[model samples]
Target: MTQFAAEMIGTFFIILLGNGVVANVVLNGTKGNNGGWIVITTGWALAVFVGVVIAAPFSGAHLNPAVTLALAMAQKFSWAKVPLFILAQFTGAMLGAVAVWLVYKDHFLKTPDKGLKSAAFFTSPAIRNNSSNFFSEVLGTFVLIFVIFYFTNAEMGNDKTPIGLGSLGAIPVAFLVWAIGLSLGGTTGYAINPARDLGPRIMHALLPINGKGSSEWNYSWIPVAGPLVGSALAALLYLWLRI
Candidate 1:
């Protein structure tokens, strides 16, 4: 597949399973309604694994706007490719959210709680404070991108390495994601990926669901802006630290 196709396919699974977990937890009549933090984290980790497995060969399977932007800024990836990746990711994320909606259509109709319905499709902070929520997103994305660079350098291995190494590298990355979610995800659901947070959010607003609440418009920018800034900061820090 082409790079664009790979990115879109990768991103599709990321949002599908990532937001799928939220739907499981927050929507009515789902088994995971109260599964809480652990479930969401694990689901996302596995989702990343699935996406990477599918798209790694073609596009390196970024599936993340923050990752694409950071690698571009660091000159690790071609700047020209950045826009394509972001567009693919956003479109894929929207498709994924549509899938989640289909999977839970019955539950959405049965559920009367607007907050719960929204949570099923997207993210919102448990608390309403903007500063704390924004900071948490930034910090979370910082750690995510910084660790990604470390792992890429340490374990991605040379091209001479077997394809299986890519699969193996995913484990540590997945675990790191799990760790971040367990620690910092309480606020704003640790939306450390711009595409992951915003794409599905747009879908929630556009998709028909009963009793969905205000889109939390004021807070929406935090995840997208925070992760981009945080990833850049982390990239710079990694360069300094490596030196």
Candidate 2:
């Protein structure tokens, strides 16, 4: 598959399953209803695994824009290709979100709580503290990109090259995401990827969901900016350590 198509398809699955779990748990009624935090985290981890396995050979599975930025910053990926990769990631994320909504349309209508409906589309802070929320995202993403640097040993480029162990190579990243979600996700839902949060959030605003309420645009920047800042910091640190 082409890199663009691979990224789009991969992120499509990420949102399809990741937000899907939220819809199943938070919406009015479903088999996974109230499956709780562990279920949500596990679902997201598996989503990452699936996405990475599908896209790694073609796009290095930089399904998250923060990851693409960090790879460029670390000199492992081409700056020239950054924008294309990011566009593909966002496209895939938005499409994935739409798929989730379609799959859970009935439940979305049944769920009266606007917040619950929004939860299936984007992340929101458990407690709204701007600085604290930003810090949580930054720290969570720092852990993500920093660890990923080590995983690739600073050598994996965004070019279409197969990653190690094929499908099994995706495991470490899945576990890393799971760890971040379990340990640090409570504060701000661990929106460690700009495209992952903002893309679907845009969709939440545009889609015709009943009583979906405000898109929470005011607080949207943190998820995008925080991850970018964290990614740059992690890349800088990795470069410095190498030096």
Q: With candidate 2 superimposed using the best TM-score fit, by how many Å does residue 137's alpha carbon deviate from the native? A: 0.5
Instruction: Estimate the overall C-alpha local distance difference test score of candidate 2.
Output: 0.87
Q: Write the per-residue lDDT of candidate 1 for residues 95-181, one digit (tens) a residue.
A: 998999999899889789898887765678888888888888889999888777765563243343322213336667678778888
Question: Top model by lDDT, which number?
Answer: 2
1-243 per-residue lDDT for model 2 (tens digits): 987898888988898999998898899889999999999999999999999989988777888888888878877777898888889989999999999999999999899999999999999999999999999999999998888776554355324463221223688889989999999999998989998899899999999998999999999999999999999999899989888
Q: Lowest-lDDT window of 10 residues in candidate 1?
A: 159-168
* Model 1 per-residue lDDT at 126: 83
Clashes of 1: 0
lDDT of 1 at 187: 81
- Candidate 1 clashing pairs, residues 3+ apart or interchain: none
